[model samples]
Target chain A: GDKVKQSPSALSLQEGTNSALRCNFSIAATTVQWFLQNPRGSLINLFYLVPGTKENGRLKSAFDSKESYSTLHIRDAQLEDSGTYFCAAEEGQGGRALIFGTGTTVSVSP
Target chain B: NAGVIQTPRHKVTGKGQEATLWCEPISGHSAVFWYRQTIVQGLEFLTYFRNQAPIDDSGMPKERFSAQMPNQSHSTLKIQSTQPQDSAVYLCASSLQGEDEQYFGPGTRLTVL
Candidate 1:
């Protein structure tokens, strides 16, 4: 089984609507990070978490290590937000290596 | 600036040929990571290096894949006897440690024919 799993392999949302992406971890993740890869193949780090929630602009993310899961929420989806979303999990204690999930391709229709 | 740099935004190689990808990490970053993204598997971790030394290469293929960081400024990933299935986007990222955000470069997209 994959250590990290992402829901909704692809998403289509209308601009100004809300959408959410989720990641479930089977491994005992010590940390989690979410990233967005633009169409140009440039990946931007969105959030780094350690069992908590954080929000930036219209994006919100949460990580729960005890249950082994993470979620990324997008509010007021915009065309500029359309991209592939990926979440990576790190399980080994004090280790920085990450196991990436199969990304979710998101497209915001205007 | 404040980002990782990768050269040769794209490359094409023939079957059984060799290819090399380069990455320049941000100054002062101690840890560097390499990942491969494909349409089928999405993002896959390849290896990681810290302080110019390999820390984990378990994700790399045992046959034709090798990576090295001879200096703090940059690193290289080499593939010998490339196959068509090896085509994918190779991304390089750098971070200070487990705490800082990992900065990624505009990946090098490889096409093997």
Candidate 2:
């Protein structure tokens, strides 16, 4: 079984709309990180959370360790947001490699 | 500050040849990680080093894949006897000692023919 799984393998949104992406962890994830892999193949870090929630501009992310799940909410989607969103979970603590989800492909159309 | 740096950016190797990928972690970071990404596999962890010491390599293929971090600033992933199946985008990442937030490099695309 996959240690990390993402829902809605692909999503299409209109500009100014809102959408949510999710990650479910089978491992005992201690922290979660969200990244957007742009069309150019560079991964831009979006959020790094250890429980609770974090908001950055139009992006908000929440990580619930107890439930072993995380959510990334995008408000007012823009064309630049069209890319692959990946959620990675780190098990235990320091020096551990992250287990990445399959990722959700997002396409924001004008 | 510059994020993680992966060298070559792209590489082409014939089957049975060898290929080496390089990664320069962010300054002051103590942990370095390596991953391989493909359309079929998504992203898979290969190995990781903390302060130049290998912590885990459970995800690495036992046969021809190897990784080394000789110093705090740089690490390398070497693939001996490369095969077409070994082609993928190799990514390097780094994070602080106790923090789980990792910064990634642009990645090196390895193509085996």
* Candidate with best lDDT: 2
Off by over 4 Å in 2: none
TM-score for each candidate, following the candidate numbering: 0.95, 0.98
lDDT of 1 by residue, A3-101 (tens): 899988899999999999999999999889999988787888999888899999999999999888999999999999999999998886765677888
User: What's the true lDDT of residue A75 in model 1?
Assistant: 98
Candidate 2 chain B: 10-residue stretch with minimal lDDT = B93-102
Candidate 2 clashes between residue pairs 3 or more apart in a chain or in different chains: none
Question: Model 2 - which docking category?
Answer: medium
Task: Chain A TM-score per model, please list them.
Answer: 0.97, 0.98
Runs of candidate 1 with Cα error greater than 4 angstroms are B98-100
State the TM-score for model 1: 0.95
TM-score, candidate 2, is: 0.98
User: What does the interface RMSD come to for each candidate?
Assistant: 1.9, 1.5
Q: Deviation in angstroms for A48 in model 1?
A: 0.8
Question: Would you list the C-alpha lDDT of every candidate in the order shown?
Answer: 0.90, 0.94
Model 2: per-residue lDDT, tens digit, A1-110? 99999988999999999999999999999999999999889999999998899999999999999999999999999998999999999898655788999999999999
What's the true lDDT of residue A61 in model 1? 99
